[model samples]
Target chain A: MTISQAGSYPSSKGIKISTVDTKEVLCGTALIKRGFAHMQKHGVIMDVTNVEQAQIAEDAGAVAVMVLDKLPYDVRHAGGVARTASVKVIQSILDSVSIPIMAKCRIGHSSEASILEEIGVDMVDESEVLSPADENRHIWKWNYTTPFVNGAKNLGEALRRIEEGAAMIRTKGEPGTGDVSQAVAHIRMVNNEIKKIKGIYDNNDDQELIRISREIQSSFEIVKETGKLGRLPVVNFAAGGISTPADAALLMKLGCDGIFVGSGIFKAEDPLERAKAVVIATTYFDDPKTVLEAQKMIDEKKSMLGLDTKNLDLKMQERGPTI
Target chain B: MNNELLIGVLGLQGDIEENIKATTNALKEMNLKGKVLSVRYPEEIMKIDGLIIPGGESTVMGLLIAIKNGLLDAITKILQEGLPVMGTCAGMIVLAKKSYDKIVGNKRQLLLGVLDIEVERNSFGRQYDSFESKLNISGIGNDYKGIFIRAPTVISVGPQVEILSKFDEKIVAVKQENIIGTSFHPELSGDYRMHRLFIQLVTNWKDANKGHQNF
Candidate 1:
């Protein structure tokens, strides 16, 4: 009963204490923000434009709702400078749902992020779904307490975003395409790169490891950690072009920590049923029967007609920092 | 035979992995034989000697546990049966008997209601107001760094609940029998002292109950 009793278990592990005195706990450490992201694992984050849509998302079992001024597809067609949702719109959705509300801020738009933080949004997305505010720079995320989720297409992109203090990372698949192929391609690229890093680490190729870290524009420490863990040090979700339960399930199976559905739910005829189905699919992604059951919840003909990613003019995936 | 303690972290939502890592590190540091598992179902509750409810969005976590998974009753039963449980942040809110969101007003939701205390959600205001400070916990070692992230504040406690720690004269931690609740996230603090204390409590509880029943 008391831990004083001697046992056969190994006691060789020595205790290590962190010597660094943390003067400021800062909004949340990368680890703490990553911890928050972990809470959303196995859950769905739906994008909503209004209070009603927010309620539908919540009622459909969405763990969180991303507040947006326009759906990604609408933004694509309207062709204007996309920015953070207005404070009034965000406040209305915040008032409507008990679940956490996340809002999108344009890439490198720290001012927009600050405003969203000021208005009390739970999380901010340095979203590729919105127009790039700055071509060469990203929001120095460490300056804010609200965690930021950024999009990445490959390991280097993912690592660069993490280096920039992104608490969460998602694949920058072509949004509004209703196509899962690009998302699949991005995730696979990241995964393959991770596997290669792990192989190099296993082979004890320190020189190659350093080279990869440089190529990725990330710290060697984080790069090595990712190699050892065989996954991104932070939570990675799949986003863009995910329009169905099956699409969500596919990404989840492909090793995403979670799935983000923008323009997928509300754009559908039955947002309620589609959202709920996507949530179920995410929760039971590995089980084909469960995914099939979830898939049965929707009417494909009534779903939003998705564009092919190949024909898209603006490539949001290629918009961020190139490292 | 080795008496290895098994700790379960509620994995339904919130900082599940971080708590697991912290607990694992704590067990190693204390030279305790234990394994930490992330518990997602009602049945997993029976397999562990202690539990941790991590910080996360309380409403979503509550909805999943109390409604979607129907584990609230099961959790309450275990707490009454003397399961040593520690809840941090939103976890603390979930364990309390009464809780209110300061920004959202007096709308109360379903909680575990095990700890007899009142909690005001986001007592430190918004994410912008979050801060970290070293404080003296009543029983733990001195200068424990507490990480407050949109943290809740313990406004009141029942006669039986003991105040463990405070920040800026605000209630931040409390203990009632085998249950422990902290408004700030100890798991995120990179310190294992709190978890070590919980493990010690679990060991003592196990020792006391050895002859009474098998856990």
Candidate 2:
């Protein structure tokens, strides 16, 4: 019943918490101004344990890093069961980082997740929907204090996560398969479905109810309307399969909130350079102007080994919760 | 006696004073009596023709009402006689027949039991994870702002109940004959039209019951 932390304090750094009554919602650009607008900085979600590789992302502009089950030098695994790792790994990352840290888990591994929350990890993911080795396991329960970011194989999967308390959504491509199309298709589907229901669902509020319902459906359309699928996520990005800065630019064009390059950077020859390009691509996913400004870096070829699907531990395959 | 109608606001807990201030201020603005009385006794139930159960943690409110002398029995007796009641957030919770998660906490918590709905506490996750969104409500002309803080969602609306509104298809509000329930709080805002609508229900009921009382 007790949360570890709450309350706000003013700092000399000029940070302030303006309390907005989210109870009753208004329509139009106000929602855009308040809810979905500020997350435009395409977040970087790094899922590595080695501090060196982790720093590559941090330096290259990843908004946050995800500490994982296998250390980079372990050479024994790529990912693990709903987060089957030592608690100390997560604890160390919490100690080492100032930015947010993310961790992965299987559908029912909520107990482990609770431990991660205790470590103060900022976000959690129910991964494996992208991993080619396992069947999909739907995760509706996430027992942790950190906000969740789930993967969507398609639109229905995405909406279900939103209904189940997930704060962020991303498209899933088969990890280790070196494919970006699945991620692209998934993003398109989510955008279209939300637009259709936006107005119909918007109008049906009951007056006799105590408080007025004051929120509008989020504009998933912003992601769909954008032309390219190889996107740089700026707002709430969790779409993976960004192999290069070009791929990232496509996602930004597709309106992603952030980027998750599980294998894209680590598997690449120049993890640092690729990471740098991705950071630039997401920072300006839109404004042909900004992406154009970041174009020089976007064109550079940084080859990644891609996940060697055949060599991956077959036993490690498992389905994760939806996005 | 006052030309304007009188309505009781259940001052149990959660967003109690907020609802009172909003409802009272609304009535003042409308030039209506709208006496927003804080009723904790069965005797108090008879004073106001209508009631507003503002949003709150239901379990706590139920426990408190259970200890308030004969208050629980009084509420049940009044509801059995068919009084117009509107419950928001936790208030809507107390109106239901049963709640979820094996109903932990103290045994004193009981409902007035007017509606047949089954409620699940924290159905949409815990309070910090609870969200506010605009939802379509019946009778209200526009979208009512739904503030779902530690809200109780109606898992199953019983036979006599009418489903009111939903978010992502989850039932967030419901109504039965004289009792209305919502998962969100309306009194938290400046909007008085919904409060006005409930008052009209009470006024019309009082007007209809006057001749019957004399008989």
Best by TM-score: 1
lDDT score of residue B101 within candidate 1: 79
| Per-prediction interface RMSD in Å | 6.8, 16.8
Listed in order, the DockQ scores are: 0.24, 0.03
Q: Which residue runs of candidate 1 sit more than 4 Å off their true CA positions? A: A1-39, A95-98, A217-222, A280-303, A320-323, B67-70, B211-215
Candidate 1, TM-score vs. the true structure? 0.86
Best by DockQ: 1
Interface RMSD of 2: 16.8
- CA-based DockQ, model 1: 0.24
TM-scores for all predictions:
0.86, 0.44
| lDDT (Cα, tens digit) per residue for candidate 1, span B1-215 | 23778888987556777888889999999998888998766777766788898877676667667543546766877788887999988888988899887776665466888899999987877655566667779888668878777789999999999999877778998999988999887887778898888888899877776511224
Which runs in model 2 stand beyond 4 Å of their true positions?
Answer: A1-41, A70-82, A129-143, A199-238, A287-295, A298-301, A307-323, B1-215
**What are the per-residue Cα lDDT tens digits for candidate 2 across A43-147?**
456657666776566555565676666522232343432244467776665554433457765554555556665565555666553232224444433233345
Tens digit of lDDT per residue, candidate 2, span B7-64? 7777544445456676776677667655677665566765667778766445445645
Tens-digit lDDT track of model 1 for A169-191? 89988887788888999999999
